[model samples]
Target: MDVIVIETPQLGDRSYLVHDGVVALVIDPQRDTDRVEAAALEAGVTITHVAETHLHNDYVTGGYDLAQAHGAEYLVNAADPVSFEREPVTDGQIVQIGAFRVTVVATPGHTHTHVSYIVSDGTTEAVFSGGSLLYGSVGRTDLVAAIDTVGLTHDQYASVRKLVHEAQHDAALFPTHGFGSFCSSGPATGAGSSTIGEQITTNHALTDADEEHFVATLIANLTAYPSYYAHMAPANMQGPGPADLEVPESLDAAELTRRLADGEWVVDLRNRVAFSSGHLQGAVSFEYGNGSNFTTYLGWVLPWDEKLTLVGTHADVEDAIRDLSRIGIDSPDAAIGTEPRALAPDAPVASYPRVGWAELARDHAAGDVLLDARRTDEFADGHLIGAVNVPLHEILSRMDEIPAGTIWVHCGSGYRAGVAASLLQRAGRDVVHVDASFADVESAGMPMAEKAV
Candidate 1:
């Protein structure tokens, strides 16, 4: 038996394609199914079944459409009240695909109806633990509802223990969340691969036996997730089709200016340095590159279903569209170019200063405001002594709360601060992008404070 890992780095999730030479079982596929089809074709395997562990919260699912396209069985939890027809799977049920035997296990923590699959071909065994049992932590429990948090926390603790007890110690443990995903309740031990035995010895959910303590810590540590997540489960429940991955309608300088004048979202996908150097006056910065999580931040901050326009190089614009489509933001208008002046010839180009913490320390003044763009929990852990905390996600609604003057902004890293800085610059505030590591705060000799417990 061979298990293929399909990673979605933008959302920090994985989909699995498990096969036994001739047949494959797809699990938790994303909105885009072409990649899955390509993997199946390359492996020379027939897709016999497509299964979903639970209704996903981060992105749309393609399981329904994939199964329909291949004339395969679409498996979903029978307990879930979904809109479409499916081959409903229940706990302790065994499903056979070619030489593989899959046993479904009920592990309801990530959601009320979540399940995991243990596959064995009488010799090799693996567990596909989606959201229930993550690398270092379990999935966050509060996504279901605020009132059900405590109950789900207990369910998560038991679910991890149950999965470990049921699967063989040598069974390869593959989880769908916890690879830099917000779905993870806590930090995932940066392990590329893990086994049931390794997770038994290392994972917090299994190692810590005190249920109440685990519940408290998990609840206290939960932070805000993306605003875009609210629409995902509903869409998934209705059985979404494959994403539309076409290139956006091309816009010239005049059309780009018209969109900006109409107050449509025009995101600049350049690095923070280039963005701060010169950009179209109204465009917000959501840099697309090797390290930047352009999809996550842009999707989180933008209003859901709003008219979004992309301004960047043609390649970058195309990449950004693909990334956005995975998260269900599709068919945005685009203006592609290397320079802002070229993208919008007649529009005035705007500029801002990008600095480091050291410079802020040297130029420390009486009234110059320091803005922290991290989440409230991040701000509480430690922040500049006099900085205002307006997380990037809440920047639009909380604009009035930010004090006027030359505001210097920073985040844990500078990525989020770049987004916040762009928003501030667009709002006509005197802004400076503190584009440096937060680790330099101590070396820069800046005053810092921790929220009093």
Candidate 2:
């Protein structure tokens, strides 16, 4: 059997297409199905099965629609309380696809009704351990609130142990999370595939601690996830409609101004340097690039109920829409490609001053307000001694709490700090962006503090 890993780096999830020369099976597909179909076509096999590990809480699953399009059987756990029709798979049940044998194993931890599939051709075997057992870590157990977190962590432990015992010693370990995915409990030691035997010795969840200790560590490590996550499970349960990938209509200056006046979101998808140089008043900056963390920060910070407008080049807008769609944000009200000055000729252009780590260190020592725009847990890990924590997501709501003065902002990296700087500047606060690596904080002879236990 041949396995093709389909990676969605923006959301840090993986889908797999496995084939045995005659037929193919797709597991845990995202909203976009073209890639899965392309994989099957490239393999010169027809897709006969599409399986979902669980009702995903991070992104909309395209399994149902993809199955319908290909005239294939859609498989999901029978215990999942989903509204759509599917072939209910149960534990210990094996299904044959061409020369491959697929067995379902119940692994309920990431969600109340999650399962993993073991695929074998009677010689070589692989486990599609979706969100249960990652390479060196495991999926976060707090996503489902109906089940107590303690109970779910125990379940995760048991399920992973079972997978370790039941799979072939040489079985390839393929998981849907843990490649820079927020769903993971933490980062994997290595960002690649591992074997069942390797995980038995190396996976921290399996090797390092007992159940109680593991539970506590996992719970304590989970940081703030995207606000958009609240919308994914319900949409996936009901089954999401096929996404419309078309860019929205172009908006002129008047429409853009009117939307901004009405409290609509106007996101500028450009590099931080370009955004800091000149941008439309009130537009937030989210740079478009690989490994940019665009979707996570945008989803965490944007108002869920409000309509959104985007300003960028045609390619940037298209890429932004695609990234947003992965998090279930399918449409924007409008997009503008013309220069910001052209759109709002008379509107005042805004920019924020970017400072290096050494300058920020000096200002911090001399009593200037330093705002750390990182996640709560990140701030707790290690931060400048006098810096105040105002995570970028909570900045708008907690604006009044900020002390009156010129505020200097920084994040683990400059991306979020740049975003925070733009928001602060737009709010009429005198702001300086500490646009350097937070790693430099310790090296710059700046005093650091860990949250008191």
**Which of the numbered candidates is closest to the native, going by highest TM-score?**
1
Question: Candidate 1's residue-wise lDDT over 1-453, tens digit each?
Answer: 999999998888999999998999999998889999999999999999999999998888999999999999998999988999899999999999999999999999999999999999999799999999888888999898899999999999999898989999999989988887888887676467889998999888888889999999999999999988898899889989877777766798898988877778899988889999998898899999776878888889988899998888889988788888878898888887868777788888899999998888887577888999999998888888988999999999989999978999999889999999999988889899999888888778888886678
Residues 231-264, candidate 2: write the lDDT tens digits: 8898898877777778878887778877666656
Model 1 scores what on Cα lDDT?
0.89
Model 1: CA > 4 A from native? 450-453
| Structural similarity to truth (TM-score) of each candidate | 0.98, 0.96
lDDT for 11 (candidate 2) = 84
Model 2 is weakest, by summed lDDT over 10 consecutive residues, at 360-369
Model 1 is weakest, by summed lDDT over 10 consecutive residues, at 184-193
Pairs of residues clashing in candidate 2: none
- Residue 209 lDDT, candidate 2, scale 0-100: 64
